[model samples]
Target chain A: MNPMIAAFLVLAGLTCASALAMAWTKNLLHAALAMFLCMLGLAGLYVMAYADVMAVAHLLIYVGGVLILILFGIMLTQNSRADQYETHNDLWTKQSGRFWALSISLSVFLGILFILNRSMSSFGMVSNEIQRSTKLTHVGLALLTEYSFAFELAGVFLLIALVGATYIAKHHE
Target chain B: MNDIPLSYFLIVSALLFSIGLSIMLLKRNMIFVLMGIELMLNAANLNLIAFSRQDDQIQGLVFSVFVLVIGVCEMSVALAIILQIYRHFKNIDLGAEKSRF
Candidate 1:
């Protein structure tokens, strides 16, 4: 009814639809595009959840960083062949048996739903705390003060991971 | 935005998580499976952000940041491993040589 709820609904639709599309499509490129849209919608959802800072960070990381890396993976691992139909090699991927995949995942989803429905009464068990404003100052202060050690460790881990990735990907035996 | 209930977000996240799981189960390409993993991770992140809206300590947000960092590391390392696998076998399909694994 209201704009806020409307926005939430729209973003949620976008995210879920794109995610479904990504799963449904066999074309790898189409899936990548769908993933892009999915990430964009997720950022909007974060905004709806009042985590604007998290939204921005997510947009930057997923869209700008992870996507490009995925594209690189798709490009690098493609099996090149001289056949006529081989051009689809990079764009398309094979699927495992569909029926079991669907049935298993659907059952798991139903189980999760059942659990969530049972737990709805328990959210009230926790003390509902005051909501914070959508400002970066508090986050910045906390990252620097309370979370400084973890932040530094994350940076170091990122560096090590990148370096290790490069070393592992090199043209060596 | 303020009027939105937490259950709605939870439902959406659950839906996404399920879809990603199916994708992971169904896809043969290693890259496609990786994409599914990313989708599931994003769904978990959304849940954290949604619940953290009502949290005072902002722990969920911080934890999600670390999650993001870890995701990036995983993607990089996995891709590198994939590249190596491609060089060795000329194919990146999961379980291509099932008897070996």
Candidate 2:
């Protein structure tokens, strides 16, 4: 009945519903929209979990960078027909048979729920203290001091990925 | 003054993971599949964040940051490859009989 649980439930609902929408829709653009909402809800959930830094980073990277890239991919790869002046791109995507997908995912979901239910008793022994403090300072210090090597490595990896993507996407005659 | 239980976060992550799996299995477009992969990655990241809340070392938080970086890298590379595939076959649909993979 508290506000925190209420917010969590609302955010989780938004996330799961949009994810289902993404799964149910055949239109690629609609799926993208659903993904956008899903990412938003996830960021909110991160904030609720007390990782505000991660929430912001997730917003910037996924919503700002990745979603734009996805849109560009959709634009460049559109199924252009003779109607060159058509405003709407062919956003509809073909789907595989639903029977197998639904059944498999359903079973997987049920299995995970069963496992979690069984494991819940063991988790009771774990510390219940929730760190409500801001993690920005700690995360920054850790990234620079303890995790410096990995941080630099990630920077290099990102640079390589960017360069490689552009190279592969370039027109080769 | 009570906080949300860890189990709630775990349940949400599980749901998200399964939805992502179904999306990966159901969608035919390369980009759609990529989106599904992103969802799955985020679900794992959520689990890490939730666990980090309870851990003294905060290892899960640090690890999740790396996971985020790796995910972005994967997305960029995959989209590039998808673009190349589209160029080669004039379509990005997987398992299409017209294109020999």
Interface CA RMSD, all predictions: 1.2, 0.9
Q: Where is model 1 more than 4 Å wrong at Cα?
A: A83-90, A127-132, B98-101
lDDT of 2 by residue, B33-75 (tens): 9999999999999999998898767788999999999999999
Top-scoring candidate (lDDT) = 2
Record all residue pairs in model 2 with backbone atoms less than 3 Å apart, i.e. clashing. none
* Per-residue lDDT over B15-76 for candidate 1, one digit per residue giving the tens place of the 0 to 100 score: 99999999999999989999999999998999888888888888888989999999999999
Query: TM-score: which candidate is best?
Result: 2
lDDT of 1 by residue, A87-108 (tens): 4434778888999999988998
Estimated TM-score per prediction?
A: 0.94, 0.97
Q: What is the TM-score of chain B alone in each candidate?
A: 0.93, 0.96
Q: What local lDDT does model 2 show for residue A105?
A: 93
* Candidate that would win on DockQ: 2
Estimate every model's Cα lDDT from 0 to 1: 0.89, 0.92
